[model samples]
Target: MISGLGLSTGVAEAEVESRRSGCLWAGTSHSQGAEVIAGGWAFACTADARGVPTWVPGGATSQAGTVPNPGAYTDPQGLFSPGARQPGTSYTDYCVGNQLVEGTNDVYQAVESGGLVFWKAAAPISDWNFDSNSPRPEPTWRSTSNCYRGSLL
Candidate 1:
């Protein structure tokens, strides 16, 4: 195991082949240290489903001690699903250009680019009620209340 903020040490490395999982399991023993005070760090390995080592973002000695992707990385399966998640639900709330939204279930990804949010789904939520767009007259408490109700919660 690699060492870092989580503080982990590799004690043993063994390969176990299994047809059920259809891969070689590299059993590793790790010793975790106490809560870190400073120098927070994390560690991960690059390996295929099999015990064989695969070239992942970061390898033991790949790219002069630099990982392939720093801020982002893709999974073995070609899928790019990103977004803010709500607790205890697969449902995600996507955003568009910093405009928060309630997303649907079709597309499973959300991305923020150029100060705007984009979704992979075909359709997105399209209902915005600004304070000025309230039905009530201006300077009226009813208008303000209507605006708040029209807007998201």
Candidate 2:
């Protein structure tokens, strides 16, 4: 015999958005076919008649980092092409660098190669003032908001 029992139900809300508003801007590299998007915006890096990569901001200009280069490398990995697979290694070696904390000048990129994708982000070592041994003040993307929406199973 079974007593009165039932499964409990509740609603879980989820949303997705860009983690960092400007830490890294989204733009295409000067390649034949490469597409990059961030924060629900498409960054198109078009080339001029002379084959120079140009920055085309889809939504808003990024607060920090440099404009992306299109098609420069076949496998764009952390600071190095064919980057490491571990996310932590890439983030630390490139994004955070030797700095104690993450900086805004850090730039990130997504590369697709051999039917696989790689991600990398880095901040310029020069951005840190050696004399003071402190990181330069710049806008950074700590985390994204509203980037996903679904119910937890």
The number of the candidate with the highest TM-score is: 2
**Using alpha carbons, what is the TM-score of model 2?**
0.23
Off by over 4 Å in 2: 1-36, 53-55, 60-99, 103-153
RMSD values for the candidates in order, in angstroms, are 19.8, 16.8
Off by over 4 Å in 1: 1-91, 109-153
> Which tens-of-lDDT digit does each residue in 1-153 have in candidate 1?
365566444322221222112211112211122111100122232333333322221112211211111111122121111231111111233334434443332222233344333334432222111123222112211222222323522
Question: What TM-score number comes out for model 1?
Answer: 0.16
The per-model lDDT (C-alpha) reads 0.24, 0.30
- lDDT for model 2, please: 0.30
